[model samples]
Target: MSRPLVIDEAEVEITAIRAQGAGGQNVNKVASAIHLRFNIAASSLPDDVKARLLASRDSRITQGGVLVLKAQRHRTQELNRLDALARLHELVQGVAQPPRARKATRPTRGSQLRRLAGKSRRAVVKAGRGRPDLS
Candidate 1:
């Protein structure tokens, strides 16, 4: 098993912004949403992890190598901040371990024969669905 990745809190940039949607009167007055930006190129993560993160297909990752996350699910700034941090941690953990290399193997003779038998049986069943022969 690979070791867990630890991201420095200081490395993450968090900003408070007003969430969009119907939030009554408090929505206009308070900034409860959190905007997070993490620069993969500047982070202290491992080389492979950094490479994987940069190469990820997530649209949030920009050409400048910065990952942008918006957390507005919660009603409070603190909750949104935590949500953003959790998401960042999840993303990092996902690519922390390298995928296992696959070994190639061929089908056994018995299995091949069984597959052929199943195919022939299916063919017979399908053929039976054709028009009946009228004498």
Candidate 2:
């Protein structure tokens, strides 16, 4: 998120294919869906970004480091292509920034004392319900 990275169209392989599912008769007749594939290894993205992307373990990514996406949400071919590109950008951006290192922390003294005090109050209530001195 620090810097927006641009993906060149040449790096992506987009193909038009028929969209599956319910649609007037046009679904079977028109190739309105788009199949997009981008090879992370061959992209111009930063080396660190590429490494993280490949290590992401996303099922959409093939063993060869290719990201495959299918966009058929839109009825138009152009819209579907744009949708696929947008999704690709989103994926690349997700892995662009490295994760921040975690810092070790400990509970404050006041919090520790407050927890013990609550436990003592509960114990007294439970003990009162147990027996009437059995006398």
Candidate 3:
């Protein structure tokens, strides 16, 4: 298997922001959450990888091809920062490998027969519900 893409530290911009939700007194004062921003267009990744990353349906990737990640699971700023970087690494790695091409195939003969049989049975049931024809 090919190795995953390694993002350069300089390409990522991390900011420590105040975390939301409950943490008692520490939550109100400490800036433990890390917000990571990486511009795919400006990064050193391969052209194909960049295209794949941008084309992904992930909400984290913005319209301008910038990835935004928030890490606040940890209480400490250092831990949050590391978490953000790890997440970013995974995101890049996700698009590193090309997707497998889907092979088109027709339905099996047995399945087709089963479908036709079901349709005919339904038609018979519907026909039974109709009014009796006068001679």
Candidate 4:
């Protein structure tokens, strides 16, 4: 049996920064943006999950195997913090479930026949593009 996945809140580091872009005068004064950082190498997650997370091609994962997420959609700092945590949960949950193995398949006999017939028709059309037959 595999071990259950669990992420401790203490392992996550959260910081509040200023949000960028237009937002009247309040945007520059308040630190509403949330910056969440989770280190995969130092987390309690299973080894497999850690491996998969580091191997992921997501732009959020840094070169040092740390997951960095920035949340600024909400105007309040508390909401942005929650949003960042939610996103982190989603990423961890995704890695917890193993991917289904793919089953190789071949085209049915009827499909193969149809494909061959289409190829033959295309060849005939291309052959017709050549000079017309002379008597």
The candidate scoring highest on TM-score is 3
**lDDT per residue (tens digit) for residues 22-119 in model 3:** 99889899999999999999999999999999998999988888999999999999999999999899888888999999999999999999999999
Go through the candidates in order and give each one's C-alpha lDDT.
0.95, 0.95, 0.94, 0.92
| Ranking of all predicted structures according to TM-score, beginning with the best and ending with the worst | 3, 4, 1, 2
Q: Is candidate 1 or 3 superior in lDDT? A: 1
What's the residue-level lDDT of 17 in candidate 2? 97
| TM-score of candidate 2 on Cα atoms, chains taken together | 0.79
- The clash numbers for all candidates, in the given order, read 0, 0, 0, 0
lDDT of 2 by residue, 60-105 (tens): 9999999999999999999999999999999999999998999999
Model 4 alpha-carbon miss at residue 80, Å = 0.2
Ranking by lDDT: 2, 1, 3, 4
TM-score versus the correct structure, for each prediction = 0.82, 0.79, 0.91, 0.90
- Over 4 Å off in model 1, which ranges? 125-135
**Model 3 misplaced regions, further than 4 Å:** 129-135
Candidate 4 structure quality by residue, lDDT tens digits, 54-77? 988999999998999999999999
For candidate 4, the lDDT comes to 0.92
The positional error of residue 99 in candidate 3, measured at the CA in angstroms, is: 0.7
Candidate 1, residues 13-106, lDDT tens digits: the string is 9999999898987788899999999999999999999998988899999999999999999899999999999999999999998878999999
